[model samples]
Target: MIRDATAFLNRSLAVISGIEVSGLALVFGVLAIFFVLLWLRASGRARLAQRALQTAEADAARLDTVLKVQAEMSGRMQTMAEIIGSRQADLTRALSDRLDGLTTRVGQSILSTTRETKASLSVLAERLAVIDRAQGEIRSLTGEVVKLKDVLANKQTRGAFGEARMQAIIADALPSSVYAFQATLSNGRRPDCLIRMPNGAPGLVVDAKFPLESFTALQQAADGETQAAAATRLRRDMDVHIKAIAEKYLIPGETQDTAFLFVPSETVFAALHEDFDDVVQKAYRLGVVIVSPSLLNLSIQVVQAVLKDARLRASAGRIQAEVRLFGEDLERLDARVTALKGHFAQASRDVDQISVSSDKLQRRGERIAGIEIGEEAGPSEGLKSVAGE
Candidate 1:
């Protein structure tokens, strides 16, 4: 179409050149308008091409920068992956080591606790055994207490018990030679014990029998009036026993002025002293002394001390005689020692004189040996030289 339009334009221009001058002016105006339109279209096309080139360059720059940024980001991500893997490995190893330590500590703690629990159980077992043994001993003690209660329940057995206790105390405190059990006095009455005093002093009697029924009743009384009646009966019974012991045991010449009324029970004796003071005074006035087991033991100790003093007094002359003989023997021994010393001194002086004589003889023998004689000298001449030396 553009070629056709160019041909048409060429024909028109030739036509216009041959036409009149008025027609050429009109033709020139139309050519100018077409040229201006062509120029404007060409300018618009150039500007569009420049804009497209600028846009393509900008797109290429943006693509290159995006590629470079993507590559850097990939490197950083790879480095971060390596760091994360290392950190994970380190954390795993650290956690493993800590877990191992914790496991070991827990195992040791469990073992220690087991051992401590075993020790505690063993100690508890031993304590339980000790408690079992103690319980057994308590049972045995309870049985023995019951037996003792039974023994004290009977009056005759109780009386015998009191006598046995009194005898045991006396036998332990006094010698058999100094005391006699159930000895018959001159009046044909037998006393429980007769203690022979020292230095031909009168014998002392001990009566072990005591009344305990009224005292037992007093202890068992339920009311005030009953208690008072029991107390009165106990006082009367005590008075009767005191008088009997005083009358039966006391002898003017053969026995001591005081006789012992032995009350084996300290409780009973204390009761008598506390509640029945008048009875004790009456017995004291009648030459009968009420004695508990402790009092009897003490009295026996005093008697033993008196006997020891009397024995010492009786042996005074013999001890003096023996001392005199010992002194004489000491004097003799001293004199003999003095004589022996004198003999030793004389022998030492004799030995010294003998040593001096032997030294003198040795010197003379050396001088004789040192003397030289001529080979041709006669025997008589040598003898004479020796004698002269």
Candidate 2:
């Protein structure tokens, strides 16, 4: 039994050992499988890490290149900004200078315009004042013209007006002494005025009576028949007046051969010249000069000039007499001046001889005083020396 037990024990021990060995082997195999799986995972993880590291390295390189490009762009941007700022500064300065110039020119132009406007306003004001004065004068003149027209409406007033106008013209043109108003002639006819001639002969006679009614009718006629009748009446009236004046004023030795038929109205005179050539010729034949106020004034002025010429001639004769007297007086003055010069020359010679005598007397007196009480001064030698001097 002991032996069998021991062998069984030994067999159990061997089986147990085999089981343990198997378990150990199984553990080792599992460990080895786990190790292998871990190794495989690790290797995969390592490969993923390597791939991630390589992608990270490439991204970092790309980031570095982008950062460098960004830095260069920032520098270029700063430089561009500085250039724009400099250009803006230059543009601002130039615009400011141009605005200053324009402002100065505009100010000067405004000042000049202001001065010109002031001057124009002052001139306009002066012209307005002058116009106001002219307007006032025109008003006064219009009133006077109305009054004059009223006065000229009647025949008597018209005749008086003509006479007064003739008198005024005569008074203005001739001196009071050279003209007479309403003087009775040698034929017992009263002439309106008479102008004294320069030769002291008979004066020129002027008659102021005119046929104004027929002239007025002629002027008022509108129709041809009325105008013709009025013109015929005017010619007849003028012929009668011319005959009357020729018979009344024209005297052989007392008055001029031609008598003036004074027409105060210039219109009437113009109408006579224009339409009544036959009447004018008749008046000329009758020695009646149809004179308007203007013509009469001219005649009076001519008379004045003739008188002035005569007076100048008379004055020239008187001046010649005075000049002859003045020449005689000048001759007398020259003779007196020559005589006075001769007297002055004689007085100078006498003064020179007296000075020489005084010198000779003074020398002789000194010689006598020096001769110690018995002086024998030679008067003949002193007198000879004075004569020689």
Candidate 3:
């Protein structure tokens, strides 16, 4: 390629006009301008072509080197990928085994927790059953008690029940001396009950029987006429009972002018007033007061007031007795004190006489036992005994 380029240059120099050759050097002195222009243009193009050819050859060599390098790297990359995949498989197996064991343990824990919950539920159920049984027994016992109380409220036994209960209430409310029970009125009929008055005198009397069965039957009657009949019978019975008691027990200025006929049941009192208005009006005219237990309780309060005054009087009597006894004791004490003072004065006079006799005897003894009477002179020498004998 260099030889071909040199031969072309020789031919180009030979064909030029007015050109001279100095050995291998060609000179176009006058045509130097054209030559310079042509050389500039052709040299630049020829240099560019040479550079392009060199660059193409370098590029081809570089491509061959790149292909060989890529082949070697591909083999290395494949071997490394196989090794990494085996390690990953080992790690995955280890993780899977660990997860399986953990899952098994978790399942066992869940089962145990479930079993405990079931056992607790069973115990709760048993406790609930026990509570249910206890509630049932309590309800049954309550029912029986209610039935017993209802039976006592019936007319057959209500009178006795009320009397016993009322007596208990009275006993609890007052002292024994403040009241008395079952006192005989002056009319020779013993009143059903009595209370000591303010002066310890007889108090108002009460009769405690009033039938409720007929009234209850009246209440249970299907028709108004039957109810009216029941009412008539109850009212008539009450009037008869009151009249009998009044005839037997009510005496002028003896039994309390107003007497109480206690209706143990309010139902009977209500029946007389509600259905048999005329009979009640008659009872009022007869001066017989119809009283239920509640009304009688109010009447008893009146008796209690009288009893309070009686208690005060009794207490006054006790005070009077204490004062009398105190006066008697003071009189006896006064006599005893007078005797003590007299005895004390007599004892003092006897003591004065004994003192004088002792002084005389001491002087006589001193004269009989005489010695020199010096600074310690004996008293007998200093005294003149009887006649100086």
Model-by-model lDDT, in order?
A: 0.87, 0.86, 0.72
TM-score of 1: 0.58
- Backbone-clash count (model 3): 2
Worst 10 residues of 1 by lDDT: 8-17
lDDT per residue as tens, model 1, 1-389: 98875555455343445673343455677789899999999999999989899988998898899889889989988999999999999999999999999999999999999999999999999999999999999999999789768877888887888888889998988889999999999889999899999888999999888887778899999999999999999888888888887778788889999999888789989988998888899988999999998899899999999999999999999999999999999999999999999999999999999999898788778867865767577767766766664
RMSD of 1: 24.5
Superposed model 3: Cα runs more than 4 Å off: 1-155, 178-188, 266-271, 313-389
How far off is residue 51 in model 2, in Å?
79
What value of lDDT does candidate 1 attain over all alpha carbons? 0.87
The sequence of per-residue lDDT tens digits that candidate 2 reaches over residues 1-389 is 98875554444232443463344455566899999999999999999999999999999999999999999999999999999999989998988998898899889889999989999999999999999999999999999789779877778888888899999999987789998998888778889998889877779998888878788888899999999999999888888889888888888998989988889889889988998999999999999888998899888888888998999998998999999999999999999999999999999999999999898889777765554433364666555544454
Q: Rank the candidates by lDDT, best first.
A: 1, 2, 3
Q: Residue 335 error for model 1, in Å?
A: 2.2
Q: What TM-score, over all chains together, does every model reach?
A: 0.58, 0.52, 0.41
lDDT of 1 at 86: 98
